[model samples]
Each structure stands twice: as structure tokens, then as C-alpha cells.
Target: MKVIVIATAMFLAGAASVQAADKVTFQMDWLPGGDKAAIFVCLERGFCEDAGLDVSLETGRGSSESLTKLATGSSDIGNADIGALMAARVTENLPVTAVMSYYNQGPHAFFTLRGNGIEKFADVKGKHLVTSPFTSSNVYLPLVLNDNGLTMDDITLTKTDPGALNPMLVTGRTDAVISWITDVTRYTRQVEDAGREMIVLPWADAGLVMYSGTIVASDKFLAERPDVARRFVAALLESVKYMRENPQDAAQAVNDAVPELDHPTAMGSLQDAIGLIFNEVTERDGLGAFEPERLKATWDRVAAAQGLDADALDPESVVNRNFMPEN
Candidate 1:
């Protein structure tokens, strides 16, 4: 009887530990893809579980929609663009704050064939450009043009469905397409099949320095579950580090979670996107560090694009770095 009681107590303790794993809903700012491999890798490869978290994933259409979800408590924490968060803070005082910088540079870029007349930003003048109507990239288009010594008047712009932008560019229907570098492989594949090489003129290289995909959370989540939030951030950064070291397994994790996605395709996406996370800026500032000057510059551009007052946001108020773990 004494031996039986001991075994039963041990079993009950084991069950309790299992139940104690914190449940977290990680909202995705977009659908599952190579760029989104970080969250999926963490969940599928057991990083979140290792951190004592029972994480569930959710998909979103865009940063604006994801911000709405976070603001209303429909979700807890997710990846979003810092510029979107800044705009939201100005338009609506949402409680969401970015905790860690993910992509330290903006992914916005113009893709075209190298043989095309639009090899440089200055070359975009008097060329036909295509872009999707709903993308946040549209808001910053004017600023990119201004930096290149051009304006909306210089280019004949077409707003179309996202699916059609690349086709237009590759088929020579348009001279260039404004898109994100995250889709480099996808666009490359399409352009290659068309017997042309896809050339990406990234806005970051052309002077649009700002923070993109960042870890954002509702204020309530931070206040109510500080430990879980901290653990999640640590696990997320760990996943990114893992991705850098093991690109194959990291990309495979995405297909493991969403089997509809092809493995090689996802791998291509991961290869193109990994640089956005672990580049010169990351090396200089360290992972997830948002320098004061860059943060201010981000707000300045966001304000100019959205026509919001620069003083509308302090630039520092939209972020809370307390959730980031110490080295």
C-alpha cells in the first residue's frame, strides 16, 4: 500500500506539471510562409514547449487587421510592422506596444528585370509601375519616389490585385512592381521561368530605413502575464538563431505545421528572408535592439506617408523593451 501511494502521487504531480504549461495564442501578421518561419519553427521544433508554453498559432491578413485583433484582446501577441503600430497609436490609442524588433529594416522594394530600363530608383521616372492596392507599401511609395528625385507624376502607376503585380512586371506589362523582399524567391522563380532575372531595388538601400516585422503585444498581456511574455520573446529569438544555423530544419518546420506548403518552396522563402533578420543592422545593434535615432527616423517617415503629426507620437511611446530578455 505504501508503494502504491508513492506511485500515484508521482503520476498526479506529472499531470499537474503538464497542465501548468502556459497557453499562448501567437497571432501571425500574415499567412504562413518562409518569412513567417520564426513562429512556426518555435512551435513545431518544440522551442515554445521547451519554454513551458503551449502556443497556438493564428493567421492574419495584414498589420492593420492584426493590430485590431491585439487591441481588442482577440489575440495576445503577434508580429506587426512598427510603422503600422505608430500609425495606429496616432489614429487610435491602442494598448499594443512593440516589445522586440524583428526585421530591423523595411522589406519594401521594387522588383524588375535587370534588362529593363528601370535598373535604379532614378530609372523609375517615366516608367510604368504596378502595385497592389491594399498593401501598406503603397503608403510609402511617394516618399521613396521623393528620395529618388521623382514623384507620382513621373511614373504611370497601376493599382491591381496582388496576384497580378508580378505577372505584369515579368511579362513586360509594367516596368517595375513595388513589393516586399520577403517574396524574392517567389518572384525570382516566376521571373526566371520567363527567362529574366528578378532584380530587387530595396527601399532600405534607397534610404527607407525603418523597422518592419516586430514582436508586438497588448498592454494587458504584458501587465497580466509578464513571465509568459518574456519566455515567448526568448523562445522566438532562439528560433531565429536556430533558423540562422539550421535553415533546412527551420523551413521544414513551416511545412510540418502547414503541410499544404511545399518544402523546397518554403526553403527558398526562408533563405531569402533570413538576411532580413540577421544582417548588418542586427550585427551592429544586436538582436532585437531598437536604437533611438532609427526609431525616430521610422516615425518621421511614417508620419510623412500617413500625413500624421510627427508630434502625434513620441516615437518611443509605441514600444516597451522591458519584455525583451537580457543577454
Candidate 2:
């Protein structure tokens, strides 16, 4: 896939038709992908504009960088896993708070080849595992390892780039790599084209539950620009709704934003993303409803893994549901 230049005429027409509003900068956790459909959807479907927000969604190198950008005020808003924020708070006391979680369930996982003989979590013991060395992965891997009666010392943990995970596994450099279930859809074609089979070990399967792709803002900005932040979250929830109801349209919207996504891959990715984002939410309390019990549970898990006291902190330490959509 290649980046395409969207016609300036359309943007110009849209700009001409809409009045200028408070501009908000949104930094993504990574480059445009299926997990980021809500951001692109908000832009493509004019949800941000309708909410009186002039949103600029920029690509980030990773969660660490995105969080840094948020903390340093380089961006007004950002998206990342809640665990990422927790680790940051512990490591450096970064005052970032999740406003509303997009994916209530964590999607990150250990991906492997089906025929590679890694059919279960127990098989991960003593295996050569490739993973991001960031705090989020650092905390998650050990938790998973401990859950399976193993520790980090039991496996061969190699520090690798997120993009290099599949190649390392395919070439026998690593047995498995940390990834998101979204990878199955986005990189499936590339993995197949490389003649490799793929299998996903979802975190959900291993009793590892956490929030993924949450919209967060630094405390300073949330206090200074609460109106804009609230509008951003409101638009974000609307975008989530769009992705859930009209997945094909959401896919096309994401393809429009990313441009490198070809038609076939984009369609398949849209379907996969729908499953990733829309699961359980529609049947329950709907999108962007921050569940206090789930938030507390995730916090306790992270605290236990990090050897911190969960009782010392409150839900306010991790989440701020003040901006979530009304039930």
C-alpha cells in the first residue's frame, strides 16, 4: 500500500462550508491502522466538526511517544492502552488520565504460526519470545508468564520492534511476538504473501483483561481545555458508533485516511476491525461507557504485577469518566 494524495478540493469545500472552531490536536498511538478507525471515522464523517472541534489527528511512533507528546503538551489528546498510562505513572508519575476507553477489552496478544506448535499459553514457557521492551509489554509479559506458572526468566525474551515481530518469528529468530489481534487482519495478507501461517493468542483467553485504545489527555490540558476535551470524547464515541453500525463504511473511511490500504485488504480489515471494536459493547452498555468495576480490576492487575499497592490508589488515579457518554 502507498500513501495517496487526497484531493484538496474536497477538503477545501468542506472547510469553506464549515465555520472554524477550537482546534484540538490528537496524537495516535501508532501510524494509521485498523485500531485507529474511530479517529479517522471522526474526521471522515465530520463528527469532530459537528462537535465544534477542529481535530488534527497525527501519527505517533508508539505508545511511549504518544504519551510523551501528551505529557509535554505536544498534543491535546492521544490514544493508547490504559496499562501504558499506568506504567508511565509508576515509572515517571506522568499525570495522564483516560477520559473514555474505546475498546473496553484489551486486544494485544502473542501471535504465532499455527503450525509452529504454539497452540496454548503453556507452550510459551522456555520459548524464544519477541516483544516490545516498553513498560506496557514489560508488565504484561511477566503477568502472562506468571499466570502460566513461568516467569520472565523462563523464556528467551528478545527486544524487537513491533514491525519486526512477524519476520523474526517466520525466520525462526523468535517463537512468538507481542501483537494485537488487529494484526491478524492488517498483516494477514503480508504474512500469507511471505508464506507464513498465523495464529493469535488473545489476552482475553489468558484471563488478562485491560483497556485498549483509550483516549487520554494530560491533567494540565484536561483542566485548561475541558470543553475541547469533552467535545473530542463526544465525537470519538460517535465515531465508535459509526464503526460498529456501518463497518464497511468505517473501513472505507479508514482507507481514505491511510490511503495505502488497497480495496480488498481494506474490506477484510474493516470486517476484522468491526469484530475488534464492536464486540460485547453493543450488547451491553454501548460504546464509551467507562465501567468503574472493570477499571478498578484492570488497575489492581497492573498494580499486583508491578508490586504496588492497589489500595493506595483510587479509580481517579487511572481514569476520569467525567467525559464519557451519558448512559
Candidate 3:
């Protein structure tokens, strides 16, 4: 009888432990690709499991779309552009907050083929540019143009499906296409395959600095499961560190998870992604840290572009720094 009772207690304890694992649905801002290698690495390496999480990945139509999913509680967390999150907060009054910034330097940029005569930001004037309406780049184009001494009147803007932007540019239907700089490796390969040379004009270079990819959660989720959010961030940063330290293995892990991804392209994309993840700020403040001044600058610029009152929208309300891990 004593042995049976001990066995039953052990079984019940194991069952409770299994039931305690948090179910976290992580929505991606785009399709599963090389850009999301770090998240994939975390999932593949059992880091999330070790952190007491049962995390799942969902493909998102775009960054704004992902934010919508988080706002509606469809996803527990999401990786999205900070600009889009700000726009959503101002326009829809969503209670979503970003916790960790993965892309300290925003990836928004314009891609043009060499010899297109659009060598500088000023050259974009009087040229044809294609972009998707949902892209963060298009959403922030006004600010980018204004900062560079230009405006929408200076360029002919064409709206198209995200898939069509690259094709339209490569086929001469447009002079350039706006996209994320992280897509450089993939798009450059495509252009080279078509016998064309690709040139990227980064928004950061033109003084349109902002955070790009970040981990965000709805207010309800954070309020209810703060521990889970912290664990998720910790596991994610661990995966990022592992990825940075072991590029080749990390790339392989990504390719293994998403078999359709080309190994070499995955490696190159991860390398570029890492470059965006770390900088002097991240070095000094630690990874996943946000400088209040930098956040305020980005928020002000985004709010101004959207014609919203920057002072009314407190940056701290949009971002909660309490969730980041110490190391």
C-alpha cells in the first residue's frame, strides 16, 4: 500500500509538471525563411521546452498583420516592426507592447539595379518606385523622403502586392522596389541570376533610423503570464547567442527545420540578420536592451509621419522593458 501511494504521488507530480508548461504561439512577421533562423534555432534546440514553454510558430502576412494577431489575442506573441506597432497603437488603440528589439537598426530600404541612375536619395526623385501597401517601408516612406529633402511628389509611387515588387523591378516595370534590407541576400541572388547587379539604399543611411523586428505581446498576455513572457525572451536570446557563436551549425539547424531554404542563402541571411541585431548600443546596454532616447526618437518620427501627437503617446506605454533578461 505504501509503495502504491508513493508511485501514485510521483505520477501525479509528473502530470502536473507537464500540464504547467506554457503554450506560447509565436507569430512571425513573414513566411518561414532564413530571416527567422534564430527563432527556428530556439524551437529546434528544445530551449523553449527547457524554459517550460510549448511554443509554436505561425506564418504572418506582414508585420502589421502580425501585430493585429497579437492585439486580437490570436497569438500570444509576435515578431513585428516597431513602426507598425506604433501605427497600430495610434490608429486602433491596441494594447500591444514590444519587449525586445531584434533589429536595432531598421531594415527598411530601397533596392535598385545598378545603372538605374538612382544612385542617391535625391536620385529617387522623378523615378518610378514600387512597393507593397502593407510594407513598413511604404508606411514610413514619407518621413524617409522628408528627412532626405524630398517628398512623395518627387517620386512616382506604385502600389502592388509584396510578391510583385521584386518582379516588377527586375522586369523594368519599375526603377526600384522598397523592401527590408534583410531581404538583400535573397533579392541580390535573384537579380544576379537575372544578370543584373543590385544596389541597396538603406533608410538608416538616409537618417531614418528605427527599430525593425521585435518581440511583442498583448497587454492581456503580459498581465496574465509575465513569467512566460520573460522565459520566452530569455530562451530566444539564448538561441540568438548560440546562432551568433555558431553560425554554420545555426544555419544548418534553420535549413533542417525549413528544408526549402537554401543552405548558403540561409548562412548569408543569418549573417546579415546578426549584423542588425547587435551594435555599440547593444554591446554597452546588453542584448535586447532599449535606450529610452533612441526609442523616443523613433517614436517621434513615426508619430509625426502618421500625423499623430508624439507627446500624447508615451514610448514607455508601447514598450515594456521589464521583461528582458539580464544576460
State, as a TM-score between 0 and 1, how close model 3 is to the true structure.
0.90
What tens-digit string does per-residue lDDT give for candidate 1 at 242-287? 9889999988999998999989889998998887888999989999
Candidate 2 per-residue C-alpha lDDT over 95-190 given as tens digits, one digit per residue, 9 for 90 to 100: 788887777777668888777778998888778888866636567677877777888888888886667877777777878888766667665666
Q: TM-score winner between 1 and 3, please give it.
A: 1
Among all windows of 10 consecutive residues in model 2, the one with the lowest summed lDDT is: 1-10
Arranged by TM-score with the best first, the candidates are 1, 3, 2
Q: Please report the candidate that would top lDDT against the real structure.
A: 1
Residue pairs with colliding backbones in model 3 are none
- Output the lDDT of residue 43, model 2: 91
| Cα shift from native, residue 219, model 3 (Å) | 1.5
- Candidate 2 has an lDDT of 0.76
Question: Which candidate leads in TM-score?
Answer: 1
lDDT (0 to 1) per candidate: 0.90, 0.76, 0.86
